[model samples]
Target chain A: MTLTSDRVEVAADPRQQYEQAMAERWSDGVPLLPATDDAVEAILAASPYPADHALCVLPPRNGVATVELIAINAAMAGVEPAAFGVVLAALEAMSEPEWNAFGLTTTTSSVFPMLVVNGACRDELGIDYRASCMGGAAGRGSMTIGRAVALCLRNIGGQRAGETTKSVFGQPARFGFCFGEWEERSPWPALSVRRGFRADQNVVTVHGGKGTFPLADIHNDDPRDLLYLIAKSLAFPLANPYLGNPENGEVIVAFNPMWAERFGRAFPDVEDLQRYLRAHACQPIDLWPAANAAMLADRGRVDPEGRVHLFERPDQFVPMVCGGLGSLHAIALPSFGESQMQSKAILSKS
Target chain B: MRTHGVYMRPHQSYDAGMSDPATVWVRRPTAAPGGDESAPAFRLDRAVSGLTIGVREDRAWRSWQLIGDIWSEYLRRDGAETITVETGAQVGQPGSDDRKQIDELAAVVDAAVVGLGTCGSCTTFTIKDAVALEEQERPVVAVVCEEFLVHGQNVATHLGHRDLKILVLPYPLEARPDDELRAIADEYYPRMLELLGVAS
Candidate 1:
């Protein structure tokens, strides 16, 4: 029997009990908060989803997760149950077929799903997209929410090492990497609105980013120059465009509200900027060796012309506006080869 | 494997959330007692006789392209019939939405080699592709850079994959001199074949 979160009793000797359960497998390597039944129940009280509702059947280990199970993870996360429910919604979005967890979990890529929070929830959920928001600082809601998802993936999805599947050096994001778009501070609408979601409703957009790529253009204030610099940065040889078709992957540009507004004013609309980015985010075919070219050509993923745009179809280039008001900095979260950005509304029913 | 299951940080069960302890599942093998009759019976040599090695590209293509050619060369040296090579833009791309290509490839070939081709993030994807082939009950191995080996293995274990294996390469996907590239191929080919459980 366990106490509810409202009634959580400090476990009698929590430390010794934790030690006997399992060995540590994470950095900072602290004992995680137990996702007890009471904790889950408290968390679930904030969400509309049923306690027993199956959220996802994670691959490799195939850990079947229920809404109540997610709440347990959320309880451990230490965020308000309502905030935790938002995390749950994000996970639901990422589990879509296009996100391809079946192929992703077992693959050798270090890339994992990175959740980007946007809209009114940015403040409500307490995501820190201001300065130093990409991965450090250990904020509870910012870091733990991400970690809880990773825990859900590991404990629930069954992604334990050498047991179900294989991947090399799974990223810190595997532990949980999430942040909100600094919409109020941004110059334009949040990435959600750019993707067609309204500004009022809170939404979570899950991107299959292999890793976070920070773009610093201390020199270019000219919108075109800054964008051009960003375009060049996206064309890095190590980027997915080098190996896969641009149409299949994504390049998420996290702009400050100020910059977003400026870009919106400059480009006026999201598609125009996406078109400009899509046109500019190309690389010469010569950058790769003949063998790679042959492989790409064989698939028709690239054109016979040396020029290769990031996307095969114009829509593959995704433009999202987020982050703090401070200008001169942007974040580009690149996609993992075949995954898609999945989205769902934060359920208000609860 | 990144670490033995014994080292699992004592975590509370997902919904249980008891700080007291977790109802952790112990690690056990699935091998039957009949002298391993369930083990795959086909020899590595028999499997790759005319395999069509599919190179599934995610973000980094040069290495995968190189790997495909290397595998083709190695197989030819063993007198196997020509191995047809193919590549894709990977998942999330609209280019090849037939996400089941690994199964299709396994049906068409004796064995397959897919590469996240590089990095910890990308390698996980390659491992997924290899596991897909394994799901079809086909022989496959995922190749990744050395730095990501531990990460890849964790992902493999998390997914409950027993058969998936990773082939390691050095970091920095820049061009190595021809001889160096050859040496890498020479070192990893035998290791990969061994991992595929096909070294005869």
Candidate 2:
């Protein structure tokens, strides 16, 4: 198929091409593969949409993302032909209005899109879901798929560090973070299944995660007690959820396989576990200083018993099973408060 | 080099004694620049008397709330009916409600002042709320801090409301005493009116 994007001539040598990319402000401070015609065409062959179809308009600069443009960036990120569909799905999910791409892209907060995948493709694509799945997994799908999207944001969306995006203390995930759920190890239904996708469909859920907040415990064996601590830990006074409307965002709590098994024995239904966590995820109003207390009281966040709950609903505390088999740890992907997580099923050329 | 799973092939072959260095063709990844056309800006060129005015305040900024309250009092004293709406959320039910309120306020009010763009995302929403008023052909002024003036302008430009009127307040408006904020409110109140095209 004929490509419509503008083509520029660059040096043949990899080292020279790297310099050219740097000079053009196309590199994310890392060397990227050349997006040659062959490379871009390979990625385009895997897309469900035509070359000129506009997938979405990304914010910060409000760039129109067409399938061809996406493929070029994906090729630059070295995305395999088979994995191009994941990148497309992620962009589609983030474009959903509830995801609040406009606000998240321009916020001073350190929030960025964190990709969570589910379904059968996780193993085939090497989307790591266990043993340092959040990082250090060196999984191809996790690494390249995430980077492709990040590159799209930079090149297609025009998301510059201090200029377009006002993110203060931008986190490492800005470089790209993608991981999957260990569906087999989880006692609960797969995240995509719970979100209403089929078990066989490859799905991507994008969360506007500020950063990963780790929670660990080895003392309590009782599921309820350990869950209580996890809930309390999630309700940290300065969390974004506590700063704004409780109905706005969800905090993703990723549990290790061992903890998931134990918790499953205590509460078979995931909804029941979520309800229990929500009930306890609150802080005494007295925890904050006078000024903060006044704000919470003004917002009507303080209940009659003088407690400030993190969120209004139980489902806001989303639980997923992933990470190493070793117990004593869970990770909380805190929300941006103004954005809701969105999920889209990956669609490939049939 | 192998990148994750994709194996990238070399762009071109190099000869042992090539007279000229070989080059390869690649697509430029950046999007085309946006259009220069901007939406029309409205103005009230009349006296404030007998006109209903709106003041949009952010729940996150106490300083802006104090200023908004003072401005509301000033507007009422000048014989204009004032409606004040405080918004905090940018998405979900709260955000939807907030935007609905802005639209409703835009429908009734002759002119409005939308504010508290002291932070990044807030500035974007501040411009957005002001644009809603402008969309109704009503005079509106978006208020932002000195630090975020450019950012507010950029958001306005990107939203195709490049000519939207903006009023700049002092930076670090937070943590200041009420009296200091009151003085600031007193100082910028007339400028806010001017930006709204209020008659002298």
Candidate 3:
């Protein structure tokens, strides 16, 4: 019997509850599951934190995200009770100062929190890491978990377009963007392990990404040549990498399993592949207008030989293996330079 | 359907051991108010005459560039040297190039004016760059649109520089005419100097 006015009174029917919730402006233009008290508590039962425990203060509205409130939103987003820990971890990661949640939520750029799930739960929760993993794949965990986080940002964080947030052309991923890495198919260590987490830890890494940049090739079979083309593609002239936060802003290159295997055969070590990409991910100085070129040159992004490297160092480009068996395509998730990728491990309730 | 328990009604409960479902209450989450911490105030001990001032422009607000150029002229007429640094010509991300320029300007300038903290991320970075200049011991006045005053203040506190000086301009300052921009430069110049602790 909560006394808060936030609670809605509806006929004792799931369909009616959903209708009322939408009329109340809670739905993100999609159908929502009834977040009944019973449903919310069931989701909260899987979390170690108490119901009233405040996890993080979301920005824009500065809402306090208590475990209970998040559980309600999660339940409404259709997240299964067992997968509640991932939602908690994603919120925790976004709350990190380096993630710049305050700025990102209100920016005009079409940036959103891109959740990369890892560890054993990726398989159990059905987080998609195969073809069309970013979207169009019908993974329940991918859909519900991502939507829960987005709803949290909208409802809890108070991010509404044309009102509080001025996000011009907010990307489609803003609705929901969660995917898993194809770690088993990769020749290198998993993304979490590479980032210093244990291989078995259920970790969620959040990146402030604008949108997906797709790449495809059917004729190129040479490994170095394919990688070189991929590197060049990553260095899109107007990409955020050119904004100059090379040290903090990271670009994620998602390679399909087939391409990953082919590239793996050529460069046995991941570091070698990174080095190769760094060498070729550059543009001629003439790519920018003269005035802009002079400015870019001033920052040492443009070398004496008139080549402008996309990033300051090779390590800034993160390579992960994922996507379907199709060998011809790759995707570049560009960073929103002001925010850094933050990762946190999920605390499984034993 | 065959009745299992001696002619049970269609709507009647068959599981006798099941307990009534407990209804849970949904409470709206609390919103945390902005923090009140501010950085120590920085003061300029000299007048604007003969002093080198750095004027920063956020390209998102096209008018800021015109205003910055106008302000530079005004400062030059007043016997002061001015250098302008335009950040984020294309986007809000302050790349290494933008950062290096900020640091270099901080090293050389006696005072600074960072402008166009009208939007969300831009305001955050505006405070960031202004605080960095303050850390360099250069007096700085962060110029923000009136609508984002509280946002700028909040970002300042979050960045651990709550006391960073802020100069609030009109809310919708973008896309104004050149004359209006020049007028803005004139109107805000005295206050900007005052915030920077520069005597007339």
Ranking by DockQ: 2, 3, 1
The CAPRI-style docking tier of model 1 reads incorrect
Q: Point out the higher-scoring one by TM-score: 1 or 2.
A: 2
| Model 3 spans with C-alpha error above 4 angstroms | A1-7, A13-16, B1-26, B29-66, B69-113, B127-142, B145-184, B187-200
DockQ values, each candidate: 0.15, 0.43, 0.17
Best candidate, lDDT = 2
Write model 1 residue lDDT over A283-341, tens digit each, in one string.
78777788766755666656556676666554666666555557767778876667777
- The candidate scoring highest on TM-score is 2
lDDT of 3 by residue, A116-229 (tens): 998888889989998889999878899999999998888787677755566779989989899999899998999899889999898999989989999999988999999999
**Each prediction's whole-model lDDT (CA):** 0.63, 0.90, 0.81
The TM-score values for the models, in the order shown, are 0.70, 0.95, 0.78
Would you list the clashing residue pairs of candidate 3? Answer: A37-B24, A64-B30, A131-A324, A244-B95, A244-B96, A245-B95, B38-B162, B38-B163, B39-B162, B39-B163
Lowest-lDDT window of 10 residues in candidate 3 chain B? B1-10
Q: Please, what are the lDDT tens digits per residue for candidate 2 over residues A201-251? A: 999999999999999998889999999999999999999988899998999
Interface RMSD of each: 10.0, 5.8, 10.3
Ranking by lDDT: 2, 3, 1
